[model samples]
Target: MTHKAIAFFDLDGTLLDDKSQVRPEIKVAMTQLKENNVLPVIATGRTEVEVAAIMKEANIDSDIIMNGAFIRVDGTVIFSDLYDKNLIEEVYSAARENNDAISFYNEKEIWCNEHNKFLLGAYNFIHTPVPPVNPDGYLTKPVNMLLILGQDNDNYYASKFPQLNFYRNTPFSLDTVKKTVSKGIAVKILQEKLGLTKVPSYAFGDGPNDLALFEACDIKIAMGNAVASLKEQADFITKKNTEGGIVHALKHFELI
Candidate 1:
């Protein structure tokens, strides 16, 4: 392992990958990295619930999920941040009125008005089993993020629902949470708490939602398959998810 210190990784298109499985080679690399003292932590846009399932399926346990909203090890929350109900309702109202699709995220469940095709597809792609049917098990006791897909009129929705802070994220998705919450803010708090602020840090992600982390971390790499704007902001562009991006990136930085 070459890259020293802790390495914060994005899940979807960075580590867990397009195939939805952390490749054997990657898992092996991460294991070695850990042994070599390079901590690999998950930093992803996925809600904590989603990340938990994904990590469990992959048999990979080290992570800091919910865009860093929560930090945990072995299913215990070491840190947490929650969104207000007032904001959640405001965001939900906007979604209902816009006729846009919605996926509300709590630490425990990802709630949708109905089953989402794309989400189902992602599940199938990754071979992850469907989540529990109970909607009451969500984080924040309601929802923390209102994930929307603005159909035919994103600009209009953006204009109309400006109160909802929207991250024009992964194509066809708009992730809305409270305006003040961000991975960087959460990470900063966690970093300070762990006395890791002085530890060298790096982040990998593929969306505008990752902008906060890209700006805050010392090393930031965007997936080659990432949204273009994020690519532009990253310090380097790694291979696409299917092309062993995480492996290449880690090897390039000598983290593996």
Candidate 2:
């Protein structure tokens, strides 16, 4: 694209619709923007393989994924960060203490033990792959984040794994990662990598996990259907995700 400045977008709630397909309007706008030499960077919590396939499906050329852990623009690696091996082992062990309610993600694979058929079913909910690991245990490569499922023991992981980043998406879902990473941090990393100078980059999201990016950007738009606190922090609020809230927010920002 090689332009003056670029737009960084979140894939799930920002670009893709409820069905996880690229909407017609978004596809049109992104194509026009790309032609104008303005790059559209896909910045999301998804990893390289997942977002890469999505980009190919959408016919776009660039993205940063794994909440910024694995990044590539066109065919180049702008930057990438991996979890600390020691931390991965420690966090996995800690999660195991809570029963078999945890799943792990590095840039590549999603790992779960064979015993938790119900949790395994959750993998099918999103249609992402979960390959069995060496010991039916933690992943070989250290993961970027951990999604723990349960309620009562919320405080347990936080207390024991104080050095890690942990938060809740729902009462049954807990998300944890190394404290230094987030979609927000990933945005700045990409902005610099692409040599963009624009301030107050536009970002859209509907989860607490996106809070860091929300605060980090100059302009933040929370979806109308987002969590209570996220809506409160949004500089502007648009329609619901099902209604293509991101397209509305982008239009309001004049990017669409």
Candidate 3:
């Protein structure tokens, strides 16, 4: 509830570079923000295990992972949004028929039908290790998100399940979530829970999945290498990720 602002960063393309490493300048900037009492949170589409490693390596503690389906702060889970079982079935059926590789996300692990090109491609793109395949069926659990290795079928899913939202997060895959789920919603929840009413919110991202995140922030920053669509709506545009964009933007706003 103080004057300290909260900065949410998208991991893959905003904070991490092509090699999937956070730039030293960005890390230093975040450290400075910490000293100034500002909260720096990772808002990413990655799983908890991956996020755990990232946070440990980066020395960050809070995060909004799985594209806003999960929220963790000070090492405690404060919010989680799960998808409908019926809709999960619909996605599973469609993927099987189309020969698309699909993975389901729970709070603990990522399980897929099989290790295929599409799934591996996404892992490679994010510079993370390949996830395991567990075809044992994960329907009985609380599945928060789905990662499909295929083309966009947003319309089909939207028409079929009115409570779901879909978007292509990368060239090789699409991400699905409940209609009410998003990074923005997660941020709003965190803000309310923390009673940060007067503090400003800043978000940085570079993909279509980041659109909703942008909507939730007081200032939206688009990485220079971000998608054109995202750039159009940005409140500010900084350098490319590899060029120390995160640190550059923070300095530009004098947040650090």
Candidate 4:
């Protein structure tokens, strides 16, 4: 069925609360959106495996995962962008030189080169456990994204490898993907693939990584707690996530 509209939501600080749990009111709002013929899609830096339970809980089937490296619509995988193994090795080496931990991600699992304070902090921030150690997983498994556990040096990596995009969503890690890949690109790809080109699109986000997502949509809604950069670009500013941001935005647009 064709939806009347589409809404893309960032997981952390937008759809999910500070504790990484979906709010009860947000769940009800999602149901209302579906009933009103609006499709809700998750646009996040997380992998498919990491969001499986959250998707089930929220009853959402579509996602732009891994910072746009993968896409799924209505339970079907439509796009997958895997990183070059050689480039992965180069980044790994660079991280090692900086004494940073690097993690490899596929749709099914995550493997890290080492367990360190940054790795633990990154996972803990998301309420997830640190991935098992498997330094060579990228050699055999397809890696769609790389997580570099570090606070600073984002620009260092960006300048060192001009072919990759680095987004530091949290203080503990940088989510790295191929250059030219972004949530915006994936939004367009999803729209074209699903014949949603004519559908009005809305995006909700709260971080720097979501700037691309905002640029891709017709309307951008920023949570009150969103970073100042994102808020500056938002068309509508809603309440804080903990204070019913999603539902308020939906109601403001009369979507719910």
Weakest ten-residue segment in model 2 by summed lDDT: 131-140
Candidate 3 lDDT (Cα, 0 to 1) = 0.83
TM-score for each predicted model, relative to the true structure: 0.81, 0.85, 0.94, 0.98
> Model 3, 1-256: lDDT tens per residue?
2538999999888888888886667667878888877888999887787777667766677899888999988788999888777777888888887788888887688878888788888888877777777765675667888988876565665676676677787777777787788898999999988888579999999999899899999999999999999999999999999888888899999898
As for TM-score, the candidate ahead, 1 or 4, is 4
Which lDDT values do the candidates have, in the order given? 0.67, 0.68, 0.83, 0.92
Q: How many backbone clashes does candidate 1 have?
A: 3
What are the clash counts of all predictions, listed in order?
A: 3, 1, 0, 0
Q: How many backbone clashes does candidate 4 have?
A: 0
lDDT of 2 by residue, 1-256 (tens): 3574466776665577766677777777778766766677787766665565778766678776766566777878777677676776776676678674666666666665443654555445445565454433454556666666566676787788777667664445566766777777777787777666574466677877778878767778888777888888988988987797866776776764
Return whichever of 2 and 3 wins on lDDT: 3
RMSD of 2: 2.7
Candidate 3: TM-score? Answer: 0.94
Clashing pairs in 2: 200-218
User: Local error of candidate 1 at 114, Å?
Assistant: 3.1
